[model samples]
Structure formats: structure tokens, C-alpha cells
Target: MTPEDHGTEALSGWGRTMRRVCEVRRPDFDGSLLDAVLGAPRLTVRGAGKSYGDAALPVNGVGAVLDLTAFDRIVSFDEGNGVVVVEGGAVLKDVIDQTLPIGWKLPVVPGTERITIGGAIASDVHGKNHPGAGSFGHHVLWIALLRSDGAIVQLSAIQDADGFWATIGGMGLTGVILRAAIQLQRVDTGWMIRNRRRTRSLDETIAAMRAGGTRQELDPERHVVAWLDAHTHGASLGRGIVDEYYAASTLDLPGAVAPFPETRSPGSRRRRSLPGPGVVTGATIAAASAARWHLSRSANSQLVTMRSALCPLDRADGWPAAFGRSGLVQYQFAVPPNEVGTIHEVLAYLGTHGLTPALATLKNLGLGTAGPLSFPIPGWTLAVDLPARLLRPGIMHPIDKLVAGAGGRVYLAKDAVTDPELFPLMYPRWPAWRRTRHRLDPAGRWTSGLAERLGLLS
Candidate 1:
């Protein structure tokens, strides 16, 4: 049955692309899901609906959309070795809640806690400590993939190496990921010891970041993320605060402390009450356009704990509602190690051109995996969030050109406005990835807005 045949409304995403490409089916079990996918004209996988753009949207004229939320589960966990195997649809927040109490945590997490493990793997997402730990894909031990031909294969570094790499950041074009084995890190406590420093300009901010990052002992975790005042100019341009965190040693733990709270399943009623489109839009724009002066003032204040500074969204009820109706777009890109200075240049350009992104952050990234389409590079990366209202014609095109000119490339998972022409330049491995997909999905059954826009599918 068509998606409309089921009386479902048009399926879209945070990017606001309104289109009906296929019938969507939510399957709880992998076996049934695989059967449906294998029998479909084509298929694409989706999780949590967290993608900021049309990357998760089915391509026009083919395929069914497989929503994996029903498959969410924490299949297994090993507290001793900090290894957690979870279903592809399990939310990061759920994983964190289960593990954090035992003095363990996911090695890497994106800004939002609501994202699914599959989405994290698909995006190869990086976080505050990217310079040290790299992308989430790096810690992945294995993945169970359902190939287009209906075969289930478990891939890892030493086994099915190429497929493992491709699927890590392949944007679900390689296959439908069934589950993943992830490595977690040990922590003394659920708390984070943080340090916050305010810099005067872009140069100082970079220097401060470099300085903080080098201090392995002081900030052992090396969770360094900066908040740039995109509207600042001249001497104050790129002015922002750097927040760093380090895991506390067990011996150094406080004399009196509370243990991590118990894991509680959110009620079905609460989940059903998630804010609708209009609410999402209002919250995101308000948060994005609020007075920068006050924000800077608050960020300049003293450092706080993990609960206070990092992952603050976890504290609020229905935190996802913060994004508002149009939802949120997290635009991230990376530049080569030698070209780190360009980050400042880009920030300055944003400020001067009155294109100040509402939120701007910088992180250092390590070498990437063998994924033909993975986004990581051995360099520094920056992530920014923009309200949809600011996507004026005159503004976005020039910004896209600027990033491309600086030898930087946008993160496909987080992008909604990148130019189709710039795709090949950003991903030199695109041709190889396309070749591999051809072998698996010869008929081009799996497609997305990104695949079509970037010529990944015909």
C-alpha cells in the first residue's frame, strides 16, 4: 500500500522538504523488516526522524521507507569491559541511562540525546572530544546488516572490512543496519568536572582551545567545545567561550555524592505528546534568536558539571520540543589540519555578512574510517545551527560557496542546504561508494534526497 493509501500524511524531516516518495512501514522485528525490504521495489531506513535534511527521505519513484523505531532495544551490556550491543533503533539517551549508573558511558555522542544508534552510525557523528576520540564509528565493534539481496551479514574491522567501512557512514544506502556492537568508556562518576574560559577573538579562542586540548591531565576527557558569538565583529569577531570537561578519578570523588539515578522507561503517553510542527518552529527560532548578550554573559560564567554544561538537554522534559516545528538543522563541516585557520575566517565572514549562525561550535577530528562516504578528516571541524527563517536566498548560496572555497566539506547528515555541484569536491570517494551500492542495490532501490541531489543514484 502507498503511504497515502495507508492514510499517512506526507513524510518530511527537520529540513522541511515536503514530499511523498514511498510507503512507510514500522516493523518491530528484523526478520519481518528484512522480508519487506527485500521484496520492495526499493527501500531506505529511518530512525528517530532526527536527520536535519532529506537524507532519510526515500528517493522519488522507488522503494519503501523502513522506520526502525519499533526495533529499539538494549540487547546486551558488559559493565566490566564497557561493551554495549544495542538494536539500531535504541536511542542514545536510553543507552546512557542504562550505562551511566555503572560508571560507564558511550564513547561518543552528538549534541542531541534523542538520536538513534543507527543514525549515529550512519552519520559517523563526532562530538566535543573529536580531536582526541574521533567519530562514533571509531568505537563501533561490529554491525549486523541486511543486504539488498536478503542476506544478513555481521561486519567488523577484520571481517567484511569494506562493507563495514561503507556502512559506517554510508547514509543507509549500503543496507539496512539491524544492530550494532559499541564500545563504552569507564567513568568514576556520572558527573563532569568542567572549565569555562571566555576569549576575546577568533585567534584567542583557537589558542585557548589548543591550550585546553593539550592539557590531558586537567581535562582528561578533553571535551572541548566553543560557543562563538556569530554576530560579533571587528576586534570582537569570533568572540566566544570554550567549555572543557574531564572525567574525575575515583579516588578524587567527593566525600558525599549521589549515585546515578535509576533508568525509567518514559511513559507511552508522554512519548505520544511530543510537540507538533508549529511548536517545534516557535521554540527553535526563539532559542536561536534570543539576545546573544545574555547568552554570552551566562556562558562566560564559571564552569559547571556535566549535568549543567554538557548534555543540558537531558534535564528538560520533552527536550526535543526545543527545536520547534521546522525542527533544527545542525550544519557541520571539516577543514584539513593545515587549514584550521580557515575556521576563524569562516566565522568572521559569517559575522561580517550578517549571516551569524545562531550557534557555532568547533572541534578537532581524528583520521576517518575506510567508509567511502564518511565525513571525518584528520583536521578540525565546526558545527553550527541555523533557524529556517534565516535561510534567505542571498545568504545560503554565498555561505555554501565560502565553505567549498576554503577546502571544507559539509556533513551530509546535518546538511540541508549544500550545493549539489559541491558534493564530488567534498567527497572524493563518492564514485567508489556509488560503485559499491550498484553491486548491492543494482536497481537503485535505496535512494534519498541526498543520493539524488549528489548523483549517488540514477
Candidate 2:
């Protein structure tokens, strides 16, 4: 079991925060995977590096960062049953390209399709349709996990449920995700019928979500989300646009599942990369926010590709660069149905500090997941992206306490700075998840920067 030395390299997640220098290694397929996991002194598995924080990084700037992109492969697909077997490193976009041609798509996907299947499972990512589709883990039929003891085991909801759920949102602390068999959903086209509604206030935005049903009941067919303008104040505070979508098949002629178009959307050619810090400011954000609101207000119903409807940020590519060198911190928290005030309080806190969030969205999350560490619960969730420079310890800490007190939890995938002391309160199931994670890797061989910071590695 020998490993190759790729030398030391600097690594960070999508947010470009907490950059760490770590020894790096890339193992080839089959026998090489086992050798890589067993031969390394200590390491963390990284896939596409799409997580917003340190979950993919090495702790304390030491250890090997295992690059698994080479393991990407679509092993096979059972079109009859809508199940596809893919390597852990397989990207979601690739899966969609191949499977969609045959009338199948990933049952659940995150905002960015560039993320790897392995990352999705490790994070248990959710989408705009979370209330109906749940998180990525719910769609996984089984995972082939490489444990710390050098054993490969198969896990599923029914078989080895403890190991399975633990690995779902365990932040790669349990073991290496070798691959997985995923259940796909059928789609007739690659497009969605989108409708936009302008909301006057935060209350109206949430009421639109409840319009589908009760505050808790979200219509499965209609994918819903809202874009908020944090710059507005007084009567206009929380003014935003709400978007509702139905699959193209619901209104258009049903046909073979189509692939994402090769041609880019108009104005996408003008997209630019983030050059450095100080590019994003309150003034720039306000202008952009106003432009977005006015543009949506003019359109009521339109035909948009699933890519446009689901992952609009993908078009901007390196848009986060606008946040400058300090990058950005995305604080996404979810609360129960009755605790709606938490949203108002947090937003008002940001407004009072004059730190306008550059980007914000609100959605209704449905069922709580079986994975103990999974973030979503049945209620409303709001995610705000603020420039790292503008956010101080004084601000985030209070928001943390507010969220924890409201019986809510932050999304570990998007979190970079939450006091470890507040973790247990936010995620009460941590003890159970930790126990299962320990049983899978009793030596605590699988750990990351996030695991260590949040005291998940004991």
C-alpha cells in the first residue's frame, strides 16, 4: 500500500476562507484507493472543493488533502428503475447530461451542479424543492464506504442504517466515500415553467410560501424560493421577489429528457471572474439587488432551463470574487414553524449594524432528515451571504445564540464560524451521530478542519 506525494498545496472551500497548506495526494482507481486511505498518515477527502467552509480542508494546516476527482466515473445505469451507480467523484452535471437523455435525473441536487456526488452525500445537500424532495441522502440507495480500518462496506437506509445515516452529513469524518448507487427522478425536459411575484415585505414573502398550503405544507410540484433585498429599510424592509416553478412536463409537451443546452444564455458571455477584495460593497449590492427585483417584476410567467431556475449562481461562475479577498460568509439557519421571529430578529440585527447582506434567500424546508447531523428541519430557512470583512465576531455570535435558542441549526456545509460550544444546542443529535461515527472509525482516523474545530473528533 504505497502512496504518491503530490507535494504541499494550499486549499480552501468555495468561500475562499480559512486557507490551509496541506500535503496533497491523488490516487488512481481500484487498488490505489485502498492504498491511499490506508497508507496516508492522516488526511481528509476532498471532492471538487465546493463546500463554503473548512469541511473539505485539513485541520490546523496539517495532513494530506485527498483529491478524488480522478475517481469520477458513471459505473452503470438501470433505466428501468431510475437508479444509477456512480463513482464518488462523479460530478452532478455529468450525471445529468448522460442520464437525462434517457429520461432520468438526480432526484435531488444542490444549487451548483459542479459538486461531486461524494460531496453531496457527505453534506446531505438540499435544493429549492427541499420541502418535497428532501436532501441528497434521501435519494441515495446505498454508499460504498472505505473505513479507517481498511475495510470497504456497503451502507443503506435499511441495511447498516446507523453507518449510513452517520456518513450522510458527517462531514467526511466517518470514512472515504468510494461510490454510491443513487435513485433518479424522471423528467421530460431540461426546462421549468417559472413564475415570479414581487413581495412588499418579509411577511409577504413567507406568506407566499404558505400560500401553497399551510405554513408547514409545501406543494411538491411547485419549487419555491425568494430573493431578498437587504438594503431596503422601514416599510420596504425585506422587500423581495418570490419564484415558483413547475417542471416543464407539467405544462409543456412531454418528450425525452433533454440535456442542458450547450449554448450559453444571453449576457452570460459578459460574466467576469472575481479579481480581488473590495469589489463588493453596499452600494454595488444595492444597485444589483434593485436591478434583479425590477427585472423579475416585469416577468410573470416564463420558460427557463432547469439550470437557470435551480442554479442561477452558476452563471456568474466566480461571482463570489465580488466579495474581494476576504471572500464571503454564508450564514444559513433553519427554525421550526412557530419560530418565525428568529428570521426578523437576525435580519434586523444585520440592518441595525448597517451590514447589508450581499445575497439572501428564504425557503420552506419540509421533513427532518434521518441523518442526525443533517441541517434541515420542518420550517422556514433563510441564508444570507455577507462579505467576510464586514462580519465581526460580535455580530455572528449573537445570531448564533438567537438561532440555537429558537431550536434551529446552521447548515454545516455552509458554516465557517459558529462557536463550538453552541453546536450541541443547535444539533441535539450530535451525540448519536458521534457514537455512530466512532463505531465506524473507532480510531478517529477520518477527521477534517471542521471536525476538529467543532470538536467532532474525540
Candidate 3:
């Protein structure tokens, strides 16, 4: 569809809170319109409107939201070598559907598949195998960037290295990502052979996860994500299981599907028919409730192949409806490697303080990216989803202080409660990032809620 077809008027995202600075412009695959926006008074790029927080929201609505969805295309794919190049607006689900049938898969993916490649790179998203694969940016070979000065720049580790590092996880403040070449991993089959082991204590769960990380042959697709009963106390604290897996070859199986089956729809049929904020919220809540119930049951755990275990979110229609009307906020933070024990302590505190999140997931990240405000580090990261109603001062504020004290910082892409003062403490590279950003965007034309809250703009 053309820009005018979707309406030239400004549009908000799925969150509906970040209104555009100027009229939304949907440019075709070429870089001409993007170049114009870069030279305009102010500009920012947006895709899919799936970002949980405000990373894609233009600051002050002064510039325009350069809608890149129109640029979607898979430029090339080499199944034998497992490398694919695509435009920035290509959705993760789209890539997976095309690649998985050929025994290839994205190296990493976030919880949701509705996100665009540009959005994923802007957030530098990670997945269950982050301890091994690192963030998505690590797998990227090069990117086509529309620079602040209206120049189309091709950046890689060796070419334009400085700009490349600055743009990855730069929250798209530096420029618009036009296209990217990513390296995909080879898998034996579309199915995952999974192992589910239940642990009675947080310590046991941690030990199991650490042990699982050492087994290279297993190449697990999922990890330890827990469902802690807030009402449970003391000895029963942090009781959960770790689910690990490896891709299983389906060559010997009869009538095995070449590509994986689509994910089951998360919301009800009636709910799917409805539209607007109210219906979306209700659907999200219902989905979350079902997921929580499923996880809570201690059923027979056995081995399952990759396709069954690592289902992409978008494949399951109506999945977005699970968060309900108030919507869900994913609060993730990383503490020092030595301070992971502190995460358990914080969980205990949350249980006692009546702030236990609905869902809690943990991962071990390798190192921090060079982005001025990147979130990962050589530490353990925990992500939790909480209802917006729980964001009151009495609850979230103290939790923020606790995380800060532990040398932890919230993920900006998932954050809605982070206090501005903690930005410098969590991200030591902020000053350097700001320096690079000023050099590229001296007028600070590009901005977002994250930038504004963290004082990233001068």
C-alpha cells in the first residue's frame, strides 16, 4: 500500500500513547524519502508499532514517524550457508516461516514475533539462548543506514565500525535502518527435543541453568523461566522448573511436516473479532491467565523437538490480546554476575511486598553492547510482566531502588517505571553514547520516551 492509501495523517502505535511529531510518511523501498526526512527539521523511523514501551515514539511530535513497513522485503536467502538479507521492516515471523522449512532459523528472537527487523536491532533484543548467541546485533553482518545528514551509509564491523556500533541498540536515534544482513543458524529439523526439569528452590534452578549452559551438544532453545507463587514462603520460595531443548532431526519420521505448524491462537474467536483498546486488553489478560495456568501445572515433562517448543508469537493469531486493557509492562534488569543471588533475594522481597509479577524469566547475557545506552552485560537478566495497575509509587518505586542498589538497570525497551537518575548508574557508557549521538544528530532532532526520561537529549 502507498503512503496516501494508509492516510498521511499522523498515527500512534499499538500502545496509543506516543502520538507522532509530524504526519506519518510511508516510503517505498528506495532511500529517497528517508533521505528527505533526515534533512528535515526532525525525524524518526517506526515499524509495526509493537514496541512495548516508547523506543519508537518520536520526541515532542516535531519530526515525522518514518513508517518503514512499506520497505518489507527479503532481498536474498542462501539456505545452504544459512545467511539472509532483508529490509529493516521485515517481521521476525515472516523470516521464520520462510527459513524454518529449509532447516534454518533465526539465531535469536524475542518473546514476540510481531516486531520488525529495525525494531529488533534498535532494541538489540535477546532470547533464550542469549548466553550462547548474545543479542541479535551480534549476528548482524552489516546494515544499510540512512544517516542524519541524508546520506545512505553501509556499516559493518570493519566498515564504518564506529557508526555501526553506535546504531546497534542506539534506539534508532542515530538514523533509520534501511536493511540488514543477518546470519542464521542451521538446525537439524523443525522440532525441538526438550527436557523439562522441575526444581524446588531458586538455588537449584540456578544450578541447573548453569549446568545446562555448559552442554554445547544440547544447544537448548529455551531456558529457565519460572512461575513463582507469591503466596508461598520461606523454604518453598522460587520453586520452578528449567526447560531445555535441542533441535531434533525429523528425517526419519513419517509424514513429518517440512515447515512447523502455526502457533495456536491465544485469544477466543469472539475476542478476535472485536477491535480497539478495550478488546485488546481483555484478550491479552485472557491469554496471560491461560499461560500462567499452564505453567503452574506440574505435568509430565518430556522431550519435544524445536518446532513444538520454540513457537513464534505472531504465528499464534490473537496472541497480543492476552495483556488486556491496562496492558502489560515487561520489566527487565541485569545485575552483576556475582549478584544473581540478589535477584532471588529481590524475588523474595517482591513476594513479601505483594509485588510478585505475573511472569518471571531469567537469562545469562555475555557482555554489554557498545551502544551508549545498551542494557546487557556479563551478568544475569530477569524479565517480569506486570499489570499497569501495579505501577503505583508504593510498589514500583521501591523495586526500582532495589534494582539500582544491586548494580542493575531496567531495559529501556521494556521499561515504564525507571527513574531518570538511575540512567547513568546503570549505563556507564551513556556519556560516550551521547557524544556520538551529538556528533551525528547535533540538533537532537530524534528522540523517544526513553531518551527524554534518561536525559539523553541536551
The prediction achieving the highest TM-score against the true structure is 2
User: How high is the CA lDDT of each candidate model?
Assistant: 0.70, 0.82, 0.67
Model 1: CA > 4 A from native: 1-7, 15-22, 60-62, 216-220, 259-309, 313-328, 393-395
lDDT of 1: 0.70
State the weakest 10-residue window (summed lDDT) of model 3.
Answer: 265-274
**Candidate 1 lDDT tens digits, 1-458:** 22332223367664453346557776666667766675677666888776767788876655668888877889999878988999999888888878888788887777667779998998888777766777889899999987777777898999878778888888988877788999998876665666677677778887887776566324336687777766666887666777777765544455665545343434322222234533444344335534543465423323234444456434443433344444446678888767765776777666566456656778766667788788888777888766554465546556566667767788988777777787777888878777776775654567777777677664
Scored against the true structure, residue 224 in model 3 reaches a CA lDDT of 37
Clashing pairs in 2: 277-324, 277-325
Please identify model 3 stretches exceeding 4 Å from their true place.
1-22, 35-40, 216-224, 251-308, 315-324
lDDT of 3 at 448: 68
Residues 252-280, candidate 2: write the lDDT tens digits. Answer: 73444344444343342222325566678
Candidate RMSDs in Å, in order, are 4.2, 2.9, 4.3
The count of residue-pair clashes in candidate 3 stands at 21
